[model samples]
Target: MKIIPQLLFVIAIVIFGYFFSKRVIRIRKNIQIGRKEDRSDQPAKRFRNMLLIAFGQKKMFKKPLPAVLHLFIYVGFLVINLEVLEFIIDGLLGTHRIFAPYLGGFYTFCLNFFEFLALAVVISCLVFLFRRNILKIPRFWQREMTSWPRLDANLILIIEILLMAAIFTMNATDQILQTRGAGYTATGRFFLSAQLIPLFEGASTAQLILGERVAWWAHIIGILGFAVYVTYSKHLHIFMAFPNTYYGNLNAPGQMWNMPEITNEVKIMLGAAGAEQNQVEAPARFGAKDVADLSRFNIMNAYACTECGRCTAECPANITGKKLSPRKIMMDVRDRVEEIGSSNSDEDGKSLLGDYITKEEIFACTSCNACVEACPVNIDPLSIILQLRRYTAMEESSSPADWNNMFSNIETNFAPWKFAASDRFNWSKE
Candidate 1:
């Protein structure tokens, strides 16, 4: 009987180690995708940004309710891990109430509190899923008709439910195991366990024991499987959000969009005029020629996507049916990243700004900053598109006639509107 817990613990530990190591290696490979050397010299600014974004979650609140709910989910998950730690100890070491002495009544209180909070998170996620799927929020819908909007939402809900269920069962199992005296005082505090006890009145010891084992194993298996799922699905945000947020830009949002000097050097070296330099020496032209041109951060952006479709919901081009959906763009980027990561062949190479992402889509952008402002994870797709445009205009000299004329007018007249300098003060005079 005692050996079961020890075996579960060892199995859990081994699985954890294997997954953790694999993810670390994958992230490292992703970081090398775009391979831009770190240029920030301001240690203080970087440190402050790391603290604020990673812990403060400043960027997440652009969509307030979802942000706040997600924040609670994160904190609740972290706090609840202590309960798991205690479970492993009790199950394996025979210390049934290990955390009781150290945490006093606090562990009990937190277990109950976080359990309820976790429930709220699950409910909120369900609402979000409904909004995305049944309600058919237009913003999150993809253009290729290939975006897995419903699947994405369903997966997230499943993860949240599994996590919450695990917590509920673990608590309930403990309650049953300690039926003689309410087990631990902490166990009594959990509302789920308290409610469950009444239903089990007059149950046999063997039945109770069997139920405990079932619940215990269910909790363990659910959590273990969830850990694996996170790495492969959009729910990867569950683990990556903190680290990604920590590395977030500290500078003003606008300032961070500026292409680094390395990008410029690459442009010049390749004789690429504008943003086209992003494709220089690259097999495919820049913007996002295949997925290798995309930075690790870009890949992270996809996993971190909450499928809120705030960017797509706000995109002007989508509203006009111009074939540009920011949400679809994100999905495409994610697909490309996965495709490249999984294959050794270069057959999938595609231009970032060409047929892969149409010129109309490129020109449709207004540089209005709406998409950037709307993204929950701070993904700046607008900047990526613009860089691709720059590469087209500067390196390949392949800009649209209307846009070229507009740029020429801007250089000759200092305004895209083509108004003469003499007429600049006409409005003021009138």
Candidate 2:
């Protein structure tokens, strides 16, 4: 009994250490990549919007079934930690049912309920995997041309499978133990391990003990490994996602991206003529030139992406065969940031507009906010694209010929179309 506690403690510590070290390293690297100004310090509306989207998981509901399934999985994982604690106690202290007396009948009922919910989560995840792998869902296709290691995808699959296997196995083993006269003690009282007893009829005591030990170890190992993997993989969302969602920008879907203002004196000193010039030349300023230009929250967004490809799936640019996937754009930004920080190179030499993201890619965007509305993590790719547009239009005097003509017409005739100013109020029939 004493040995079990020590073993569990050591495993926990090792898992914690792995995650802590990885998190610290990633944070430091992210900081080195740089940060954009804090827009989160804005008004109360922003906070409210972030809360509704992030906490509410509002965007995820675009794919209602998958979203609902994930919601259950997420909540179940969090609530089941209490049962996990009991499992540890059972293993170490030799107490079969550790949580029975505390919450009584009600708690047991909930435990049984969530266990069924977890089974649903497993089924849903399998469906998702099959859709991605066998069905070749267009949404899951790689939008980036660059090569990625298959190992990354395989590792994620393996981890998820292990986690589900552990959950099901643990439940089945506990059911067997309960049926074999391991009365409803403090922990096992609320859980219906009794359902599993019928399956193990005629099994010897030795077989039952071995089964329990196997299930207990599987559960512990799977959970601990999952914790460690969360920090290192794209699954970092499992931990950082909630906080990222909690601190997200909460505003109307299509709100324009704002550029910070520069005082007149600074503008004059830099020989800048207007808001556009001021934005380009301002020190510690405008468009993202390096990783450091991204806000910490944006960096966290990169880590939080589930690679569900919902953003790309909804992007008009991607559908039209343009070299832009809103999904890949986020990924590219992260990659460029890392490149800039590690190499100490200037990304400003590369054009923010054009072939890098492509002119068609920009124009293809209807600014409809479909991608933004679809993203589960609240990544506003439209805002990033607009920032690039602003830099090109203001600093370089570069824009699509059609858009430039429209701007010229708007300035000269006071109308976006080629119409006479006197005709503006023609609706007032005399």
Candidate 3:
């Protein structure tokens, strides 16, 4: 029945809305549980950053081959979704090609363009799958990649391919039905899908209609399912990248964000004028031990991570086979956040610093900022690493002996070297 299809479409819409909202609320709650810090400064610069880094994907061009392939997939996915809008309208009204009569030739042009992009998506996905599974790119096979991450990546690519195939099938069958005078709208020929016509030739009108309906439902349902799955996948970066880039650190790479209390303490110790008046109280804890102690941006950084391995690949510590993997750091944070979100209590006697990330990995970092520089979405894993290191040294007093000695010298003298400030120019005298 015509009404039956519309009824099914409405039920599917309601189901998608419910699950999508549930995941969004959980994510929002998890992100909000972290410490708050203002990142609203310089609206103009942030907007430009979002456009270039997130939308234009400027940072992905470091490696040209994968960059071009990724561009095809990314641009294709975004552009071809324009057809989904029409699909939605048609499903709701129980009509076929609702926009065909209204837009006429333009509708045909749009479908042709979508088909071209769909083909591009299929090609790009295949290349990526080959690179990941066959070529065995080292980054894709990292320690943190594990089973789920690898499978998630492969699944997303396969799904994209199948969804694109469904579109071609639907269009090809629709064109056949139109020619057969089965009350189908004549939207002219689609360039890419028209080539697929031969595949469905010699089939009866009933069979053709069945094929089109199946593809029609599959494509839309696949999209809805994808929207929900992304929240739980590393593909969350698809949406989070925009906001992450917009609020990315605008300060110089070398200029670390100091603790406010530490800054105030330093000024007071230096006896700067009015320093006592501006003195701030110390925080309950020195640095982050859990996700709750981290800032909202840090949690968001975890969520925004593409798990692309660029951060770990560029990390000097990881390159030298130290325990630190910047990608893992982000993944650990996200996992911990998810654990906290799902549990009854935020405290589980297991903290992020000790349980998820180890002291070895934290201490292995060279503080070189390579990971920060390499992240496409501007996620600063070094920031989280430093926070964990701070907790180890300040709260736990567990810094290595070599670092302790350096800290003692800095406290007494003016530098890491064990010499007086007044004799700092003695090297020049020698």
| For model 3, the run of ten residues with the poorest summed lDDT | 271-280
Overall lDDT per candidate, in order of appearance: 0.65, 0.64, 0.92
Better of 1 and 2 by TM-score: 1
Q: What are the runs in model 2 whose C-alpha is more than 4 Å off?
A: 28-32, 40-51, 87-97, 101-107, 145-158, 178-204, 251-255, 261-281, 336-366, 390-430
- Each model's number of backbone clashes? 10, 19, 0
Clashes of 3: 0
- Sort every candidate by lDDT, greatest first: 3, 1, 2
What TM-score quantifies how close candidate 1 is to the native fold?
0.79
Using lDDT as the measure, the top candidate is 3
lDDT of 1 by residue, 128-201 (tens): 77766788666555555444555756776776777676566656656766755534444446785567666665
Residue pairs with colliding backbones in model 3 are none
The lowest-lDDT stretch of 10 consecutive residues in candidate 1 is 277-286
**Model 1 alpha-carbon drift over 4 Å, by segment:** 91-97, 101-104, 142-149, 181-186, 250-288, 345-356, 407-430
For every candidate in turn, the CA RMSD to the true structure comes to 5.2, 5.3, 1.4
Model 3: residues with Cα > 4 Å off, grouped in runs: 267-272, 419-423
Error of 1 at 374 (Å): 2.0
